[model samples]
Target: MVIKKVSIIGLGALGILFGHQLAKKMPRADLRIIADQNRIQRYQQNGVFCNGECCDFNYVTPEEPCEPADLLIMAVKFNGLKDAIQSVQKHVGENTIILSLLNGITSEEIIGEIYGMDKILYSVAQGMDAVKVGNQLTYDHMGMICFGESETGLISERVNVVTEFFEQMEVPYKVDSDMLTRLWGKFMLNVGVNQTVAVFESNYGEVQQEGPARSKMISAMKEVISLSEKAGVQLTEEDLDYWLGVLGTLSPDGKPSMAQDVEAKRISEVELFSGTVVKLGKRFGVPTPINQELYHRIKLIENRYTMIG
Candidate 1:
């Protein structure tokens, strides 16, 4: 299907970056931003500003969220994915291509139950940073995002449309035969960064810069590597370096969506990242002591946040 109008059903940092980029590239293409009461009003009041390499996006969210569209890109946190999907699915159509842009190993399969895999496209996003200072968000280090449907042997016309959109927006993206590999790779990266930071109570640089902290980070990554092997995906040493390179470029103060949740005294995605590794390890009869401990520690912090609230 040739996609024109699109609705981004989340107003998080990722959602904003995605909606803005889509609208910027195809202005004639209808792009709507759907946010919950969370930060909907503030977003609707400002629009995304793609000012060079800076997070100067003054994006104003649309007051009226469109009732679905030909394309629906979901950038919401996967922990609350059920609610997020339920909220937007009613507005979406059978023809709408759903893009699960959330970080986690479960997104595509979970969404598959709700909307068949045929209707859902595998997607991954990189090189974007977002921080919400109150109602406003700042972002930079704009990177590439990619998505496409695997139509068996049949050539996909939708893949070309998505690639064309990326070309215009200058978002470095690609469509590979094993998008599943890319998804698992991204999940492993999150398991390394988000899981480690939450467990250590530190930022990206602080965690990577310190000795013991860096060791913990590597141990956590190794656990993921083990799980990847059992799950039939081999993550090489060079792969570890590539992901770390992305973190190296991050600003010391720049935080992840999971970290933001921790700061706001809310539950985080430990279960989605490290928690996922530990679970898979159990299934494969592999030991994941470090990942298991980190998962529990972070969950304790997040649970406390929920309890006190």
Candidate 2:
């Protein structure tokens, strides 16, 4: 089936990047930005800027009845996933393909539990260094999305449809044979880079250099690699090295989403990264000292806000 109508939730960094690309490539009427009434009004007034160019987007409120989208992109934060799922309900048709761009390993499952798993695809968004400050987004690399069926070596019909849509949109994507491993690799990257950066208030440049930040980042990821073995994914040091190469390609001045969240004084996705690793470490009888420390440090950072307020 050809994917024509596309609906996307969450207008953050990645959302703006993809949305802008889609708007440029496809007819404006075919893309829908789903949000509540207040957000729609606020976005219309303030406008969303991608690299200083104001995007002309079609915004639809969740309550407004419309044709079900052929593809639904969930770009909301882990904390906001539940509300986002509810918000996009009206846009989901029986044939709608769902892709959750949220970080960590469990988002697909979380989304699949509500919508049927049949509608969900395992996807990992990697190699992007996009940063959003307020409504403005800046990035040098737009990144590529890797998505496929849960089973390896099976190119399903839905995967091909999404692949064709991405090609038309001029967005880079890869159809992986083993999507689960790719997702876990992404989870490992976030568990390390996002947490360490958030705790130290650093950017990609800091972590890219050989120092405490980079050391702590790799160490935190090592803990996940250990847990992956027991959890059955069994990520190797090679996977970790692959992410390091990707990190080197990012804009040194750019930051991860968690670091951006901390700088903006907003709630970050510590829970999704370190929090998830810590939980899985315990479940799999693995030790996660690096992640435990990172988790504690980030929580302290969050606490300072409450203490000051």
Candidate 3:
């Protein structure tokens, strides 16, 4: 089906970055922002400041009536995913295509269960060094989106429709036939950089430095690589090297999504990253001691937040 109307959920870094770009291409009215009432007010008042420029797009709260979108992009954090899904239920027509840019391997599963398997697509955003502070967004890299079918990893007509939309918007994206491998590859990157950054409260550059932190990051990623092979995903040592290279190229002072969450005193996606690794490791009979340690450390940090509240 041709995609004319697109709705982006969440106003986080990726959401705002992609939303602004899409607004530039599509009619501003054709692109919608589905966020909470507070976030809606914030955007309505201040607009979205992206890359030193401000752009305002149409927005609606979940309580308001929204026309079913042709495509819905899920960009909320893992913790907020359940509510986000429910909020956008009214906007999901029979043919609405769902693409989740949230990190983790299981977001597609969760979205599929709610929206039906056929409507869900596998996706990940990469190469972005963006950060969101309040209503303002700043980024050094624009990033590319990779997506495809979940079951066969083959490009379907729906996939092509989304690709054509991106092409028309001049948005950088790839339609991967092996989207599962790509997701697992990105999963490994998140397990390495995101968890370690949150635990140590460090940035990408610190993790890249030759030190114990870097060693911990590599060890955690190796655990993911081992688990991926056992799960029949064919992740290799070379894949690990490639992720390491990607990590090396990130902005020195840039913080990952998890680190940003920790700093903002918001809940991090430890459950998505380290939690998934630990669960999968148990199922696959693979040891994930490093991930376990990182998971517990992040939980303790989160628990502190709970206590403060």
Winning model by TM-score: 2
Can you write out model 2's per-residue Cα lDDT over 57-133, one digit (the tens) per residue? 99998898999999999998889999998988999889999999999898899889998999999988888899999
Q: RMSD (Cα, Å) of candidate 3?
A: 1.6
With a 3 Å backbone cut-off (N, CA, C), the pairs that clash in candidate 3 are none
Ranking by lDDT: 2, 3, 1
How does residue 286 of candidate 1 score in lDDT? 91
Candidate 1 ranges beyond 4 A from true positions: 26-29, 36-68, 149-155
lDDT of 1: 0.70
Instruction: Tell me the alpha-carbon RMSD of every candidate.
Output: 3.8, 0.9, 1.6
Question: For all candidates, what are the clash counts?
Answer: 11, 0, 0
Model 2 lDDT-worst window of ten: 300-309
Candidate 1 residue lDDT tens string, 134-244: 445676666667566644333377677767666766667867656666676677678777777666667777765857877787788777777777777687777777777
lDDT minimum window of 10 residues, candidate 1:
52-61
- The best-first sequence of candidates by TM-score reads 2, 3, 1
